[model samples]
Target: MSSIQDLETWEPLLRLVRAAHAEQLAAPGGRFTGQISLGSWTLPAPQPRSAPGRALQVVDMQDQFTAVERVQAALRADGASGVSYVVETGPDGRPLLHVITAGPAVEHGVRSPFVGALLLVEGAVPEPWRRLPEEFPGAAPAPSADPALLERTLRERLPDAIGATAEEIAAAEARLGVTLPDELKALYRVTRARWQDWSGDYAAQERVSTAVGCELFPLDGLYIADARSRPCPWQYAAKDAVVTAPDAAVQGLVGSPGWIAFGDNGGGDRLALDLTPGPGGHAGQVIMIDHERSIGAALRADSLTDMVVNHRHEWRSDVAWNRPPVVVQVSTHSPVGIAAAARPELEVLRIGPTGAPVSLASVAGLPRLRTLTASPGTLADPLEIAGLTDLEYLSLGAEEWRLLLSAGAVPRSLSAVAIDVPGDQHPLPVLDLANELLALWDRPLITRTVLEGDLGTDGKAGGTR
Candidate 1:
């Protein structure tokens, strides 16, 4: 058997738990549960208190560290991420230890310790990441855009600033595979913004920031902030919807190919020139891509010339106007029912615990519906999910998944799936269900080894159970 399945491998950790929680273990119907990984842990063991004269040292929890280190070593040897553990009093008044490791489909560091598997088919991404912006036929450069005026302003602001050569600008265009916007080119022509040009001078960089109204990136640093550039995990990315307001200046998208990132807002947010504008937007409008957000850019200025001349770096408004009810959650707390949420614009629907199980018939034919997440026992009939033909992502409880699997009614159009394991349910059954889902897409299955042992009546390590 692998070390992960060997009783000896877990004895040290069990002994530490028994020692720390002796009183609790001695109590009637006592139990303890926690999870541990290479980098982090959540255990019932007591933490070390700082000494009078000094802060707490690693030696204070030396025994705890050593016990966890052994388990981590076994995990590394077995190519596993982490393990969850359960300890309960046995008939003989000794502690029983159950170590559980999740399958490959489940993400590590999840607190629940059993299941929340994300089954992704090869090369498949969340729908929002795959969504491109809607085309705007009448989009054009802003009226305030003036390349010559921008260059002249920069020269007037920084007389000693060195500019890029025409050859350098052409090379950048060729490298990026897109023509640089005229305003961007003009800004760069005044100062290349290379650090080496300033000779390690902090004041020079500050002066450039003051003149440019933001921290500028060098010509080589400029890149298209496409959807691929700002990556979010499938669970989060699936919930987002791309919704552009008809009268807005920026198109709501994960990222745009036309968004050429030229600088930052001193904070981490990016400043980009938007080439793909919304219906009411100008092609060369300046937009700020927030570092905290995964989708959409905020309009910072109508034009780069406006930004530089008028110093319009402050956000006009971060909120998206004319946003439709694209995401709907149906639950006991939700204001809208499933029938009320069945709008054509609805892209995501989440079914939480409700007074009664809901029917999918209400939201079956939503054109833009791509994501659906239903909590355990929230569905009146799991088979009704087959009607959601456009579902790209679906997350449901294990029992609900089993109903669909037994009836051969799993959605073929799904790009990804998730099995939500609730409470302290055993990992073995959850792993089986997760493997079955993975097999549908020919993906790898989650595998685990079980180790069983006992803590003796005296609160010391005992032989295998």
Candidate 2:
């Protein structure tokens, strides 16, 4: 039960809101908001029927009044759609802080900007804004005296905060030689209060990310410092846009775009590489790259094109490199070559239907090859894949000719096979593929079929149900 004074920045304030909301959530009829932002964006209100159960419960607790009757009256008076409530175990008893936000209801009914502002009024001022205590003399300080200023700060700093964190990461990568995972890099970009390293500086690195944007880089992931030109580990979606910057360090000449590089000598795009498992004990056989674009593509090898045949340029910096400029590009370049070059003992290969023909031929001699995923790839090399008798799971893509032909011909030592072949797409029946593949397995395979017109409908089976 820390006072609002305990929280100076919006981060901690948001944290308190979350904690208070969570406490209220633990009680009956308590609810909190999904996101804590200024009442600017046109969000939908919580509906009793539409937002039933947890969905209905999770309202903007920070915005509503504590009294249930007051909250209900406010909602009815304002003609608002929904209000969130937090059940706080006060000295007296379990009291609630009701929250509401501007949405379609406010737009059509009130048509007043003040309505949005009114919802943010606190019973007491938080400590962060004691100087401007009048804002919420009874509750917590709202910090910025100017309501518009507070709103603007959140709008500006939220994205900038995201960018700043990215910069810290890029600078770190530039210091180290490896590009981080898409999930990991995303963890840095999304605005949240959890990024406090032991130093407690708000991961101050984000200051740099906000400065750089589409003009120079994508500003999507963290910039890294690296010595070796390692592969990136970001999974990308196709709708994502990628632009090459003229700056050599960022233009995929020395490193990938949307990423900064810090070489060992601080000269070219090379940086230090950390193959060891990071802070948590979770480590993997990774090919760390130096660019965010490549990181995006590499991690999403199935969805996007790799960095093959793309334009390659010279290093932007004038310094000589102790190590070769690791070629950086999208994820779908020559995967066969990448796999061969990686020569991973345990690799997760992401091939497309186009590269399916030569997939296993390249990784045939990979003594360390362990796990394989033929994601986004139409079909895998049945004969070539069969050779890897130590395989754990073989996730089949839309392509089935290769796997269908192998049928009972597969290795008996294989463990699991996740098939996603739809009936209409396949000339052969799904049952035939399932029956044949099941016969060759030492263990029962997790078989699945995509019925015609029912291509992506099962949520539990990776596709939509």
Candidate 3:
């Protein structure tokens, strides 16, 4: 047997678990579950608490640290990334250990026992990230826009302010690969707004903020807020939709190449000039990209001049368009059923646990449907998903995936996949199912190391090898 599979290699870690969960393991059918990797762990060991006037020292949890280090060293030697383990009492009143290593389908550093989302097709991004803003020929500068007035107002507000040179402004524009707007250039020409120029003066910073109506970024700090700038994981990103109302002033998009970020709202939100405006918007309009949101920007003002001179900082919410939702969830809590969510605009569909099994017949031919996630035992027939020819991402339970794999009906259009493993299910079957999926795509399979050990009846490790 390999060193990793040797009983002695896992004794220290087992001892640590037994020490912490003795009473729980002593109960009938009681089990302890966790995951561990070389860099991190999620064991159920007791955490060291800090006392008054003193911080916790390494000695407070030396046993835990040492035991975890031993397991990590063995994993490194065995060339494994992580392992999920389950501990339960044997019939003879000793602890039995089952260590399951991760496969390529499982993402690294994920503490969850089940395989989440796995990217099968390389370099495929979520649908929203691939979407771009629609062109509006009627878009033009706002009537309130006056570069001369904006520059004049700043000069009067900060007469002694240091401004950037024409050369400095040109360098910034070149670096960002986009021409700076006239109003933004004028603002920078009056004051560069660099920290070094302010010389650590809080009053000077306040004066600049008062003059510009917001915290201003230096010319060199300007960047195009493109879709790539705001990145989200595939699991969450797949559920988002890009929708813009007909009368919206700003386009609803993940991010835009035309958005030039220039300042902040003092609360981490960004202020940018939108050159590519929506149908009812003006060119060079100011928009606030809220830090808390992943998609869309709120219109701050019609133009930069209007924002600074008129103090037009009122935030208008995105217009509510009466269009069908692009993402839909079918559960007991949802108002709409699968039939209602079967529109051509549907991109993501999720089926949660319901009273009866749901069928995919309603949403079978959705042209734009790219993602589908279903809970275990929710689908009436797992084979019904074969009709979803356009699916780019699919997540199903182990049994559902097995049915698909058995019939050779796994969607070829899939770019990624995930298997939802139940807590009560053993890892051996889940790992096998994961490998089968990986094999279908010619991806690397998951490797396992079985380490069986005996923790004596007295809660002490007895096995040496």
Candidate 4:
């Protein structure tokens, strides 16, 4: 048996634990192998003695960076934790694997008289076993215990492994006008997990169906459901909480004109009011206060204000585009309810018709924005983003042919671009844009352009819109 005293010593316990973990990892059924081993347990740098009586104050590296760092990163990356151990010095000269039991530290020399009968193979266990805390030293938990129950309990609150509902899938397909990838379909089979708040990984790809509660679902399923851009009718399970996703698909659905109208296709048409900063330094009121209050606040404070104040710098040919455009591709089952779109100097755009595209050009004055987009029928200029050096990821529909031809200077920062064009359009500007974007990023563009119909021609000009 090992004790807390054994753990107090730094070498023996660490060596034994590492060996145990390594053996476990190397087992055929282990999740990780060939990359784990026991290493020296480096203590924290020595500090000046405070009264030379601070219980031999020592730093536990295991606590600070090692514990969370190894486990957290692994979990985040969908991997397993690394193998490691901790050891410390004891009162006796001997070293031991600290096995703390109940409330006492057993010395390394205490071997049971029935040791032969009770001893098990030292390195054959396939699980981690920890000793009791210093309160009860020398006792180690039984090794080789099944970890399934423990892992399950720990992961219970996580998003479901299964995908979204059939209704959600059908809604998104109808809205986006495209089929989802098989990989995504597989992912959809798992349960979807709602983000605690806005802004995170899911924000780019998933949005909660406010119409539906922030139910747990799979990422792929959420994407298929257009969770990122749609406004869900689902009520949140938590009171006064907002459902969030990285993508804006589902958000778009809720905000679509039809949904807003609350008709069979368009129903959710309510206004939200809130206060904002008046032109100079004055304050304004929040209209339709009963609606989403926080969204209104965000619109007034961040989105609208940004559109007005940053328009020139963010999206103007006169300004010599310098910054990177905020390029976003929101595929959702509904339309986005843009709270603010009233600037006048903005440039660069990309628009898809999962829903309505109204007043999109209204944010032209936004100084920090470069490119822009909206539904197929609503584009100020398809190529308007060309002159904005910061513009990237442009999407437009076939109706904006004139806008594409009218583009002046191609944006330099465009490394990737997606355009919706008519079959007869010339490929010259598109090629030029691709070349320019490639030069800026020094990499090939990752693009997805949609044309009115398939342009089967294999030539560069023919393949893309």
Candidate 5:
């Protein structure tokens, strides 16, 4: 038997693996006879492979997850304390692949190993994967006591607060035509407007954004995004004012004529107050609602004062839009380029050049990220990578879109998504990914939007939202 260390002996297995994968990708018109050979392996024809060929060469490049397992297996099998290996697929089809590490893997202690390459295929990228973090059901958490030292944190951001005067609150209410919640009124007394930014702890800072200002619709800086807009939609309101999209969806989610906007999370979700007291429910309670549609709502607090005093954290708009990314798309495969992609809040990662598909997985157990995105050509199943429970938004090419649609491997937890459907292919099915989402997840279906192309007049193209 050839030892695993003997690169020459492992040639046949690599050949079989390569040929098997390429064959799976074969199609009649799009049929490709080319094969990728890395290291000592050769397919039907053994052409020269360039430096550091790819270890994972399955149609879905992510299948090379086994490559990681093998490296760690080598590390532990040989009793080595640590192991490192590099696998790169050059521009040419033939790659120079090698696996010299040993062990099931332990940690990323002080050294860096060769991470996998994430392929980027061209096609339609899905929508729910690209939304902002604040788009979630509730940011931070349901209302609780504000984090300690919030006053200090606010002081750091806002200075020269305009004390709330009885006349000021009264006049504001008269103009707006709604009774201010005690908590909201107190917040006005404390600060008129403040930027939202939080980096302390994820759980504690969940919905601290509810306290910040919205330039689009500033109700004393604490603007409610999905709440009742101007021209108040109340049963009784000023005759001259124009009514807007009520936070309650005008009897869609929860029937409440009395509603008020408090804060906009930036994306679409908003912090609001249900002013109408139901038979059992109390008035002036804080709640969360989706702005795009009447999905549902979550009660945040008994009152705005409760949210500001207890259930809040410090968050302001650092992103021009609302959500921070769990996954990031890059344009290069160079190590230096990938290093630049790291940030404290980022979870998932990808590298995709225009024509060249990017499929990478060089590191594992990423600290705090919940989702990862990649090219469908490389990793058909993202779960193969350890610790990846969810995926960030995807920007895909056409061939990649066909692959994912056929396989249907997208995660179920994703609630907010964005996609760019191409208008090239004819006789394409209008993609109702929303319907698919509604079938999969129990919550109000995910928020889906198309950025670039639309499902046009003539027969729409593939991946049309």
Candidate 6:
């Protein structure tokens, strides 16, 4: 029933930062009422701000595009710090500009970075970084709340919180041949202090994870703990030469050797820092590397500080890519039970009788063991895992462990237990084990095993079918 003029399109995409909402966000910081930054001077269905709270009504409908420009200038002059859009319809209607909101201190005349984003570096930043905008226009590193707050967190923000001292941090850097970024160093300090808040075994700490980067070692354990460190999964596989520098080139590729893996994202993914900056990048930008992606992905944040503050915020649009499969992944190269001993930071362990089964004795010592991966027939010593009170994720043969669970040999904290299925789609003879594991559960668990490569032909329950 509408005219052709109203039949074009009407859509509102960007999340609106209502003047009221923006005001509320800035109140905590005692900032000024922010100025509005409209996407364009000429809008299709421009709303009139005739009401006292509305500012858009100042312009007359009869005004041409030039007059709209004047209105925009006036609004900017009024100190608007955000942008919004208008939706309209006409036979020849063209979609207007988009809306975007970025605010914290709106009352303090805080200007947003959206709209043109950044025109030029101008004189705000130093040289080298000045020309970085053109070199890396899409970089959006994280920011810090305040220096004092950061210092407190790094020092002793909480009672009983203790951070890694400068000497210890320096020593770690010497061993790794790299300097820790300020934010990264601060994060390290946080790790040491976590013990005060966390009393349970380290494996349980997985539940307390707040960001994509979990299981990250504090300054103390970075290079000296566990296997010392794992070279970037890229550039070096189980066989290729290790690459460490971000700028290191091989086969016409800029190797990401500078990435230092310090944190685990609970899942198989890893949280790392790209020490080798891109065109506009810095040495300590945060990045998430998906183990399943298999290299070529040197994903990075704008800076280490930015990532710390904006964790899972606007900066992270594609979050899933940063994480690996939820299940455990025992690399084919893990040579039996050695993975559990060598990579204590990892959640997955590949053990089997055929792959030079070293020893499951290490399981008792790993405070963070989550998932054990192997065919049930290959495990030389499932009994050795009896000491892991905080163990959670596990994969095994269907029928192999019915007695293990009934005998109370498994950890009570088990969350998920599953196995791979054969082509026949028949359940492995694990009824007793399943029932026993189910009895130990305080909550729901992943009892059904999935088919995975770690699942051996010997009726092991390692993978998801």
Question: Whose TM-score is greatest here?
Answer: 1
Per-residue lDDT of candidate 3, residues 1-465 (tens digit): 556666676777787787888888886466777777788888877887867798998888887888788778888898886677777776666567766666655564253454556767667778788888889999999999999999999899999999999999999988998888999999998999989988999999999998787899988888899899898767667767888888999998889999999999999999999999988899999999988888889999999999999887788858442235777888988887888998988888888877789999988887899989999999999999989999888889888998999899999998778887656665557767878888888876766554445553333344422
Worst 10 residues of 1 by lDDT: 456-465
Model 6: lowest-lDDT 10 consecutive positions:
3-12
lDDT of 1 by residue, 1-465 (tens): 667667677777777777888887885467777877778877777887878999889999897888788888998998877887777676667556767665545555364544453655666777777877777889988889999999999999999998999999999999999999889999989999999999999899988899989999999999999999998866777888887767878888888888899999988999999899888888988999989988888889999999998998687534552244798888999898889989998988988998999999988888989999999999999999999999989999989999999999999998778777767674556667877888888776665443345553333344454
- lDDT order, best first, reads 3, 1, 6, 5, 2, 4
lDDT per residue as tens, model 2, 1-465: 111111111122233443445555354444332222223222223222424444434354433322233333434555544432221223333333322232321111122111211111122211111111011112211121223332333345455443336667676556545575443344235332234421356344343223211111223333442212333211111111222222212111222322232111112222311222212111221122324332211110110011111111222221222111122111355433444444443234544445434446655655544344455443344556666655443455434534445464444433334444432232123334444454443223222221111111222221111
Q: What TM-score would every model get versus the actual structure?
A: 0.84, 0.25, 0.83, 0.21, 0.28, 0.30
Model 6 segments more than 4 A misplaced: 1-149, 153-159, 193-208, 211-213, 223-255, 298-300, 313-465
List runs of model 5 lying over 4 Å from the truth: 1-328, 332-336, 339-344, 348-351, 370-387, 392-408, 430-465
Residue 369 C-alpha lDDT in model 1: 92
- Candidate 5 local accuracy as lDDT? 0.37
**Decreasing TM-score order of the candidates:** 1, 3, 6, 5, 2, 4
lDDT of 4 by residue, 302-330 (tens): 12122212221121111111111222333
For residues 84-103, what per-residue lDDT tens digits would candidate 6 score against the true structure? 32221112322122222222
**Residue 174 in candidate 6 has what lDDT?**
90
Error in Å for residue 158 of model 2 = 32
User: What CA RMSD would candidate 3 show?
Assistant: 4.3
lDDT tens per residue, model 5, 113-138: 21111112222122222221121122
Candidate 3, TM-score vs. the true structure?
0.83
Could you tell me how far off, in angstroms, the CA of residue 239 lies in candidate 5 after the best superposition?
A: 41
Residues forming the 10-long window of minimal summed lDDT in candidate 4? 110-119
RMSD of each: 3.9, 24.4, 4.3, 31.9, 23.7, 26.2
Cα error, residue 142 of model 3, in Å, equals 1.4
